[model samples]
Target: MKRILLTGCAGFIGSNFVKTIASEQTDYEFDIIDALTYAGRKETIQEELNKHSFLQFHHLDIRDSSKIEKLFQERKYEGVIHFAAESHVDNSIKNPNIFVETNVLGTLNLLNASLKLFKENEAFRFVHVSTDEVYGQLTDDEPAFTEENQIKPSSPYSASKASSDLLVQSYYETFGLPTMITRCSNNYGPYQFPEKLIPVMIFKAQAKEKLPVYGDGKNIRDWIYVDDHNKGVWDVFLKGLAGEVYNLGGDSERRNIEVVNIILEHLGRSKELISYVTDRPGHDWRYAMDFSKARKELGWSPTVKFEEGIKKTIDWYLENKTWIEMVKGNNK
Candidate 1:
């Protein structure tokens, strides 16, 4: 059985990926290491915990070098899908040092551990999950960011993520450590933290509170459904060549206002609640991914339509109000 170590297994994306992997692969041994940050909750992994015999949990922080070293010393993970990091842009803006510590240095800690572990096993691969925000903003006519786009991170969050990407590349160059990266666009689905745009808007709209729109809400982002993003990760992890970077996107480009309006429409809510707020500092104007390389090389594309996905997302938020409340810190 292939042993897989997945970091940040309690976060929105990581937990979803774990559920998908556990359900699909019943024979593989999966070890999850998570710090259980504010955004990561044990409730997110409940279904997988109850259902999968091959799944095991460890409450370990990636920044703790001894803990990470011990984890590598004990298990021979055939592959690693690293998803752990401080991911909120607002939070990063408030405190940039934590972002640097966790994102840049923490990533290096994992990479170093992987380097030591790989000495015993030569064929393992490390898949580093990243975001498209690392490319900063785009002009109206500029082509979508392909692998060749220059890195121009604007925020502490994107800067930190970009820093980690550089470290991942350095490992590949200096030690020839097998590593691959996937820079995915914004992801939304079940179990998302309420701080994000989609879930926050859903909550505020449901309560008739202000649906805050940063700036004019014209900023564009390529939003991919979380399940589709998971499939993209698995595809690149299993089939992608080492030291390569793949950009994963849903090809669903929607402006901020358009996305909010769609959410309101799905919830049977009004647009009167829409409120314009101050734009974030160094906020990227737009982010679009060029996934042709991924399509041609990995033979992968998103299966969900944007409208259908949005409807499903709205329905999920409605049906899983209990989960939403828990994530909001109101249930506890």
Candidate 2:
């Protein structure tokens, strides 16, 4: 069986990947590592750990180079699906240093280890999962972002991720570490942390509390189901050419306010609950993706439409209130 290392598998997108892609790829043994940060709880993935012998969870921070190196030496991973990073933009503004540490330096450490391990196996693959924010925002008339877009990160979080993306490219260029980068649009579905837009709105609307919408709530974001994004990542890892970058998008774009209104309407809550907050510093105006390359190359396209996906998301959050409290309690 092929041994693979998946970073941040306890978190939202990664956890969905663990429950879906990693679960189905039975021929591979996945060693998942997470720092157990506020967003990543061991409890989130405990069921999968119990169910699958091919899966193992390690409690270790990617920021710790020595530990990462030791783990690399022991496992000699044939492939790496790197999904760990401090992804919250508001939190990144509060503390950019940790974002650099975890997203940039931590990625360097993984690249270093992957380089060494590559000598043993000629086909070692490293897939860097990234975001569309690295291309910055778009004006209303602008076409959707594609692989040709220039790197113009607007937030510290995106800057850090862009830095790591360049590092992966460098390794592929200088030392010939076989790597591919997959930049995806905003993802939502089950297991998303409450701090994000969708869950936050759901929680507030459910509690009959005021929903905080940033600025005018007109900022646009392309939404992809976590499952679709994970499947695209797997496709890029398995079939993408080395040193290439792929864009995976849901093709579903919605305004922030529209999303909030949808949640409120679904919960049978009043729209007056919406409280417009000051715009976040460096908030991107709009984000859209062009995933035609992924569709053409990997035969992959999003299956779940936003209307259906959002309903699923709201229902999941409603049904799994216990999980919401459990994940939040870990942070406290």
Best by TM-score: 2
Q: Model 1: per-residue lDDT, tens digit, 1-332?
A: 98989999889999999887656885678899888888889788978888887888898888898888888888878889999999999999999999998899889989989998788888889999999999989976789999989888999999999999999999999998999999999998988888999999988888889899999999999999999999999999889998999999999999999999998887788999999999988889999999999999999999888889988988899899888767778442
Measure candidate 2: CA RMSD. 0.9
Per-residue lDDT over 211-310 for candidate 2, one digit per residue giving the tens place of the 0 to 100 score: 9999999999999999999999999989999999999999999999999999999999999999999999999999999999999989999999999999
On the 0 to 100 scale, the lDDT of residue 264 in model 1 is 86
TM-scores of the models, in the order given: 0.98, 0.99
Model 2 steric clash pairs: none
Error of 1 at 98 (Å): 0.9
